[model samples]
Target: MEADHEVAPPNLADIDVSAWRELETAATSPQSGFRFLNLCSVDSEARPQARMVVLRRADGPSRVLEFHTDSRSPKWRELSTKPHVTVLGFSTQTRLQFRLQGTVELHAPGSDQANAAWDKLSPWTRTTYTGGPPGDECGFEMIDEAVLPKPQDDAKGKPHFGLLIFRARTLDWFQLRRQGNRRALLTYDETGALAACRWVNP
Candidate 1:
C-alpha cells in the first residue's frame, strides 16, 4: 500500500496582512494603477455623490489618506458640510475591493498641508485649478480658447488649491474567488492604530 501526499492550502493570516499593506503601498506609489479611488460624499439633500480622485498619501500607522482638490469645487462644499465620507476602490489585477469610511479635515489655502501639497504640483498641473469655480455655467458664445489658461501663466491657481485629509475609522476589505471569497473588517483605535480585524461573510 502507498500513501498519497496532498498540498496544503494557503495561509489566511498572510493574505490578510498583505492585503492591508498592498492598499497602502498602492496609494503611495504614484505609478501604481490603484492610485485612484472613488470619493463619495453626501449633498445637503442627502443624495450620494462620487468622483474619481488621485490618492496623494496613505499612512498605515496613522490610518490616514489624503487627496488634493480645488477649494472652489462643489465637492469642497459637500465635504465641508458633511465631514464624513465613503471611499471605494478596486484593483482589477488583484480582484480586491476596498471600502473605507472616514471623516475628512479640509486644509485651506493658507494651511501648511495645503501649501505643501501646492508646492509639489508641476506648473502644467497647476493650470488645472486656474479657472473659475467648477460647475459654473459659461456662455456658449465664448470660445474654448478664452477659458483655458495660457501656457506661460499658472501662478493664479495657487490660492484655489486645497488638500483633503481623511482619517479612516474602518476599512472593509474583500477579495473575490471562485472557490471561496474572503472579507475582513478592520477597525482603528482612538490613536489610529489597528484595533481589531475580523473576518466577515463575503
Candidate 2:
C-alpha cells in the first residue's frame, strides 16, 4: 500500500515581513485608526469576558504589547487567575482586523518597567489611573475627590498604577475587501521566533 502524504501549508516567515510591520504600525498609530481592541479573558467559571480597550503600545521586534488598566478592575483579578488572553483589533481605514493571543505578565506599580513607562506618560494620561476604583458604585448625588500626587512631585506614587504586558504567540490577520475576503494566520514559537504562517479563505 502507498503511504499517505500530507502537504504543509505556507509558513509565516514566507509572508512579507514588511506587511506584518505595517500592520503593527497601523495598530499602534495614535490617529484612532487602530486604537481599540476587544480584550477577551476567561473568568474563574470559564465564562468569557470581553471589553474594548485602547492599545497603549506594541513592540513588534520584541513581541511585547502593553495596555493600562485600573488595579482595582475586575479584569485584573481575572487575569491574575488566568494569564492567557486574546486581543482583537479592527481598522476601518484599511478594512483589516487582527486577532492576537498571548500570555500576560503584570507589572505592579513601582516596578522598573512600570516606572519607565510611567515616566513617558503625559499628565492627562496618568490622571486616569489616579482615580478611584474603576466601575465603582458611587452615589448619584455624591462627589468624592481624592487628591492624587502629581507625577512630577511624587515618584513613589507610580506603584498605584498597573501595566499589563502581553507576549503574543499567535496573530490572525484578516482583510475585508469589496471583491473578496483575505486572511493570514501566523504563529510564533516560545522564543518569539516565527513558527508558521498561512493564508486562508475568510
Candidate 3:
C-alpha cells in the first residue's frame, strides 16, 4: 500500500512575514553569516553594555525575538528592571544591517517556555549554569569542575536557566551596495501598529 501526503496552500497573511524571515535566515547562516547582533542593555546607573549574542529565534509574524543568557548574570537583572533593549545585527557577507529596538520579558525558570527550551539544550550547555550564580566572585583563578547533573534526571532542575523574549517595536534595515547605499526605517506606533516605512541613503 502507498501512503499519501498533502501540502497546505500558503497563507497570504504570511507574505510580509516570510520576507522578514528570509532576511533573518540569510543574516544568521552559519558559514557566511553567523554573528549578527550587538545587543545593548543598560544598567541601573544607565550605563550601556553591548555584547555579541547569537540570534537564537525570530518570529516575524508575532514580532518577537529570543535570546538566551545566564539567569544570574547582571544583564538579566538589568533587563528585569528595565525591559527595553536594542539589538544591532550586521551581515558582513551582504553588507546589510538590521537594528531592532524592543521591550523584553524574562521567562521564569520553570515556565512552559523555559522548560521547553531547557529540554532542547544539550548536556554540555546545561553544565555551564550548574555552578551557583553566574557573576558571583569566587576569588579563585580557576577551579576544577565536576560532572553536571542531567536536566531531566537531576533532583534540582536547571536552576539558572531562562529565556528572554523581545517584543520588537521598530526595525531599521540598511543595505550597503557598491552602486548606491540604501537604508530604511520601519517604525511601529505605540499602539502596536506599524506606522511608517521610508527609505534613505546610507
Error of 2 at 19 (Å): 5.4
lDDT for each residue of candidate 3 in 1-202, tens digit (9 for 90 to 100): 3222233323423333543675457435655353446779999999998887666777666677777777888888899998999988776766767787989989978889988887777676676667668667786645745644565553244767889888888877766655556567677666555677666557
Question: Tens digits of per-residue lDDT for model 2 on 1-202?
Answer: 4322223433456443643565467555777556777889998899999998877777776676788876778899999999999988777877778788899998877788788878887776776675557788878655635755566544433557778998989888776765556688888888877788888878
Give the TM-score (vs. native) of candidate 3: 0.76
Whole-model lDDT, candidate 1?
Answer: 0.82
Best by lDDT: 1
Q: Which candidate number has the best TM-score?
A: 1
Off by over 4 Å in 3: 1-19, 22-29, 32-36, 138-157, 189-193
Clashing pairs in 2: 12-197, 109-159
Candidate 2: 10-residue stretch with minimal lDDT: 1-10
User: Ten-residue segment with the worst summed lDDT in candidate 3?
Assistant: 1-10
Candidates in descending TM-score order:
1, 2, 3
